[model samples]
Target: MKRISLFLLVIASLFSTKTVFSQLILGPDTLCIGNELQLSTTVTNASTYYWGFCSAYLKNLPAGSSIAAGTGLAGPSSIAMAKDGNHYFVYVVNATAPRNVIRYEFGTSLSNVPLATDLGNFAGSIPVNPKGFELVNTGGNWYGFLTGGATSITSDIIRFDFGNSLSNTPTIVDLGGLVLNPQDLYVFKEANNWYALTNNGFSGNLIRLEFGNSLTNTTPNVVDLGNPGSLSDPSGMWPVFDGTDWHLFLVNRGTDRLTRLDFGTSLLNPAVDNDLGNPSGLLNQPRDISVIRDCGSYYGYITNENSNTMTLLTFNGAVTALPIASDLGNFAGFNGPRYLTRFLRDKDNVFAYTTNNADNSISRLEYNTCSNAAPPISTLQTPPPVTYATPGLYNVYFASDEGLPTMQVDCKLIRVLPHPIIEVNNDTLICQGDTILLVANGPGLFSNLWDPVYNTIAPYDTTSIFIYPKEDYRYNVHLEFTQGGGCAYDTSVFVRVSRITADAGEDRL
Candidate 1:
C-alpha cells in the first residue's frame, strides 16, 4: 500500500518547459465570478504599466547545465501533450520499475530535445502503479486515459483506443476500484457522458468515473466525491465552470496548498462541497498542475516536487495573480518536475513541457517576454484587480515599460460565464437537519424550495410528483442509494425541470 504517488511526502521534483502573446488593454472579454474589469491603453511613449507576464524563458542547461539529463527517462510520473498535425507528442508514466509508457517526438520546434520512445507494458496490464496520462481526441477515435489502480477505481479505468494513431498499441481496460491510492486522471466531457476525475493519494479522497460514451471496453459508474475539505494529499486533476459552479481545481501534496471544489454542476447528491483554499507558502511538494493562455493572462504551472522549482500562477479571474517564481537558478529546469503540458507556440508563442522525476529530463518552458530584471512589475493608471472565483479564460495585457516600447502589444480573451447549466444545481448539497440531501439526477426534482419530502424518514414518495405551472417542471432522477439507513429512493424519468438555487440553502444538517 505504499503509494502516496509512490513515496513522495517530499522529494518528487520538475522542469521540462517553453512560453507568448499581446493585446491593447481595454478590458471585458468576459467575467462572471466576482466580476470587474477596467483599463485603457492607447499608447503615449509608455512610461510604465506592465501587468503582463509570459514569464520569460531559456534556462539552457547550466547548473553545470544541470538536471536535464535522461535518455530514457526513469521515474517520470504524469504528462500528456498532443498535436498530430505538425507533430509534437509527449506521454510519460513510470512510477518506477518496468512500468513503461514513454514517448517523445518533436518537429517544427518545441526547441527540439526529443528522445525517448517505449510506450509498452501498459502500466503492467493493470497490476496498478502507473500514475496518470490522458490524450483523447473523441469520435474519430484516438484515445488514452491511464490512472493506475488500487482496485476498481470505478471499474479500473485504464483504457486506450488508438484508432487514429497515437502510436496505436493500446488495449488495457481498467476502471474498477473507486479510490484509495488512485493518483491522477482528468478526462472530461459532461452531459453527453464520458467522465473521469481521479485523485485518491491514499484516500485524501475525490473520485468520479462514469464512462458512458466509451473508454474503450466500457464498464464504469462510481461517484464517491468524499473528503470535502482540509485535504492534505488530496489530488484529483482539474475542473472549472463558472457560470455558477463546477470548480474543482486541486493540488495538495500533503498540503503545499492550492484547492477548489465547488460541485455546482450536480452529480446526483454529489453532496455538499466547497474547498477554496489556494494558499502558496511557495509550494514544495506540488506534484502536478497546468493551464495556459500566455501573455494576456491565465497561466498556472506548478511542480515543486520538494522545491526543484517551477511555480507560476497568474490568473486574475479565477483569482491568483501573485506567485511567479521561475528562475530555477536562472530561467528554469531544476529537475524532478512531475507533470505538465502547455501548447500554442504560434500566434504569440507558448510552450511548456514537463515530466522530470529528478532527471528523467524534459522542462523546456518558453512563455516569451517579460524580463526587465528581477521583478519587472509595472502598472499605474489603475487596472489590475479584476475578480473571479470560478469560471475560465483570462488574458489580460497592459505591458508598456519603455525600453524600446511601442504600445502595440495586445490581449483580451476573457470569456467567463458558465453558470447557465440549466439554471444551476449548486452541487446537490440539499441537506436540512440530521442529514438529508436529494437531486435525483438528470431532469431534476425532489422539491421546490423545501419540505416537499426529503427525509425526516418519510417522503420517499411512492412515485408520482409531476407538476407543470409556468411550464417546465421535472423529476428525471436516476438516483442515489439509501434505504436501510433511511429513505432516498429512485427510478423516475420525466425531463424539463428548473428551480435550482440551493447549495444547501441555509444548512443545519
Candidate 2:
C-alpha cells in the first residue's frame, strides 16, 4: 500500500511540471490594418509547438487549428511580427542559438512555403538579447529598433535605416541617455516634430525622446507615472499626435486599466494627468493599445495577457469592456494575447492586429462594411450686413465644425452690393436767366441720366452732374445699376427750377 501511494504522488508531480512547461507567453504585437497582424511569443521548454486563434468570447477551441506556428526556445525572449505589402514578416530568435531568423507567412495562417531571411547579425554590439523590436519609418526613411538586453555595453536603442537597397545594411543610432532597457517603443510626429516613448525597466516610468532631422541627434525627456512593479507592470506604450496635441496611452498592469496622458497644450512642459480615470478594471494584465479616429471620435483597444478579453475606450472618455478577444465564431483559440495594432484601409474601412503569446499566433479583426451616413457638413458665413453709410472694404467671416473625420471641403465667398443714393444742392432757389449752373452729387452710380423736358443730357456714369437751370421749371434725373443676383433697378431724383427777375440776375443761389 505504501508503494502505490508513492507512485501516485510521483505521477501527479510529473503532470504538473508538464503543464507548466507547455504554457506560452506573447507580447509586442504589430498591426497593419485590413492586411495582417504580427504577434510574438515565448514558450517554456517543449520539443514541439502549435499556435491558433480561439474565440475570445467563446469557451473551447479545437487542437491543431491555429493561425501559425514556430519552434520554441529555452527562455524568455522577444519577437516581432509586421506586414510588408501583402506578405507577413515574423522575426524570431532561435532557442538553441543566438541567431535570429525571419519567416514569411500568408494572411493569418501558417505556411509550408520555405520563405525565410536571416538578418545576418544582431544590429547592436551588446551581448544581451533584445526584449522588444519594431519596424519604424521617419522622414521617408525605413528604420527599426532592437531594444533591451543583458549587456551594459549594448545601446538602449538601435536604428536601422535601409537606404535604396533591399540588402542594405542598417545604421545604428545610440540613444545614450534618452532610454534605458526600453521594453517597448513607439514613435509619432506632432507639429512637424518627431517624438518617441519607451517603457523603462518595469518601473512604470516612461521615457520620452525627440529626434532631430539627423537620426543621430536624439534628446531625452522623462515622464514618471508612479510605478506598480513587476506583477501588474506596464508593457506597451502608444503615442499619437492629433495636429494640436500629443496623446500618450499605456497599459496599467497593476490595476488592469488604460491610462491616458495628454500633452496637447505644452509639448515642452507636458503635464501628465490621467485622461480616463482607471476605467478598465479587473482586466488580466493588459498589454498593447491601438486607437482609431471614427466619426469625430477616437476608439481605443486594450489587449489582455491572461484572460480572453479586450477593453475598449471611446474618445468621449468612456470605456466599454469587449469580449471579442478570439476569432469571431472561428474555433481557433487565444491563450495569452499581449499586443495590438490598428490600420486604416481607407476613410471608411479599418482593421486590428492582435498577438497571442500563448498560442504563438496572430488574429486579424476587420470592419469592412460601413453605413452610408452623411458626413458632417456646414455652411460658412461671410460678413453680415451693417447700417454704415460710407462705402469701404469690410472683413468677411465664416464658421463651421472644423474637426470632422473626413476630407476637407473648399469654401466659397459671395458678395452683396448695396443701393446708391444721389442729392441736389437745394430744393428751391431763385436764379437769374443768365444761365445759372446746377450741381448734383451723392454716392456714385453705374449710370446717370438727366432729362430736360423732351431731351436728355449729361448721360454719363459718374458721381456728380452739372446742368443749366432754365426758367422756373422742374427736372428729373435717373440712376440705374445691377443689384443682388444681377437684377437691374432705377432710382430717380427730382429738382425744382425757378425764374429770377432781371434785378436778381446778379444774385447768387
Candidate 3:
C-alpha cells in the first residue's frame, strides 16, 4: 500500500506539469492563401509542443484532421507553409538558445500526422531576436523578413528557396543604415518595382529598394514631402500611379490625418492637394494604405491603428474631400490592426484581410452584390415653375428620387424626386430685334416655349431656339419632356430686348 501511494503521488505531479505546459501562447499570427491558407502562430512559452492547421472553415475542428503536426524541443518564433503538389510542407524555428535552428515537418494529408522525415537545421544561426516578419513569394520561392535583435544593428531579409528540400543557406539582405530598430517590414510590388516599408521613423529617410534579377543597391533613394506646417510624423506611405500621375497616401502620426501627395511632374517634391484634404473626422493613427483599382478610378483602404477602423478614399483626379469609412467588422474585438490588403474574390465579391497585431489574428471580410444595386436616379423639382430674375448662384431645393435618408434604400414604390440644381448658367441676354440662340442643357426635358407660363410654343426642338424680343421683357424658357410621367417642366430665365445702338448710328460714329 505504501509503494502504490508513492507512485500515485508522482503521477499526479506529472499530470499537473503537463497541463500547465499545454496552454498555448500565441505571438503575432499571419494568414496567406494559395491552394490552401497558410496560418502561422508564434509560440513563446514551451520548447516542446505540437501544432497543426485546422481549417478556419470548420467552426469546430475535429481532433484528428489538420494539415501537419510537429514537435520541437525549442520554442518557435515563426512558421511557414509551402505547397508540395497537393500537400503542404511545414517548417518551424525549432530551437533558439544554444544556436538558432529550424526543423521541418511534412504530411501527405491535412490530418494531424507526425512529420515523415526530420530535416535538421535548414538555416544556420537563426537570428536571436526577431521583431516582425512578412512572407513573400518570388519566382516560385518563399522568403521572410527577420527584424529586430540585440547587438543586431539591422534587420535581415532572408530568402528560402524550396526545391527538393528547403535551402540551407538563405541570402541575407541587411537593412542596417536604412531602418533604425525596425519593428515591421512589408514588401509590395508596383509597376515592375518591388518596394519595402519599415516601421522605423527616419523622417525623410524612407528606404526605396528595387529588386529584380538581383537585389539592387541598398542605398535607397529618399524623398521628403515637406511637412505642411504640422509636426505629424509620417506613419506609412503607399505610392500609386493613376496612369497619368503618381499619388502617395501618407498616414500622419501626429494628427491621425491622411494627406495626399501629388508627385507633381517629378517622383520627388510631392505637393499637397488641399482640395483633396483629409476627410474631416475619421481615422486615428492611420498606419497603412492599400488601393483597389476600378474602371478608371482607384479606391484606397487606410488602416487606422489606434481607432481600429478603415477609411475608404475614392480617388478622382483629386481625391474627393468626403471619404466613407465602411464599418467593416468591429475592431474593438480585434485591436491593433496594423495593415490591410484587399482582394477581389469573384466578379462581384471583394474581401479585405486585416492583420491585427495585438490579437495575433487576421480578420477576413467579404462584401458582395455591390454591382446589383440600383443606379442613381436624379430628379429636379422647382416651386411655381417660373424663371429666375438675375444671373447668380442660387441654392435649388432638391432630393434624390430614392429619398433624403442617409442609408441606401431599395425597391420602394415611391416616386421620389431629386433636388433641383441652380440654373445660373441657363441665363440669356439678347438685344431688341436681334436673334439669340437658346439651347436646352438639362436632361430629360426637350422642347422649349417662349411664354412665361410655358403656354406658347417656341420654334425649337429642345436643341436650340432663335429668340427675338422687341421690348425689354423677362422671358422664361420652359423645357418640355414626354416620358412615362408626361410633360415634366424646367424653367430658365432670360433678359431679352436689351438696349443697343443701331448699326447705322455705330458706322456714322
Clashes of each: 57, 14, 6
Regions of candidate 1 where Cα sits further than 4 Å from its true position: 1-50, 53-73, 78-94, 97-237, 247-338, 341-352, 356-359, 370-379, 382-509
Error of 2 at 337 (Å): 2.0
Per-model CA lDDT versus the true structure: 0.51, 0.41, 0.39
> Which candidate comes out best when scored by TM-score?
2
Report the lDDT tens digits of candidate 1 across residue range 368-413. Answer: 5433222233366555544444455444444454223132344555
| Alpha-carbon RMSD of each model | 26.7, 23.3, 22.8
My TM-score estimates for the predictions, one after another, are: 0.27, 0.47, 0.42
Ranked candidates (lDDT, high to low): 1, 2, 3
Q: lDDT value for candidate 1?
A: 0.51
Clashes of 3: 6
lDDT of 3 at 245: 57
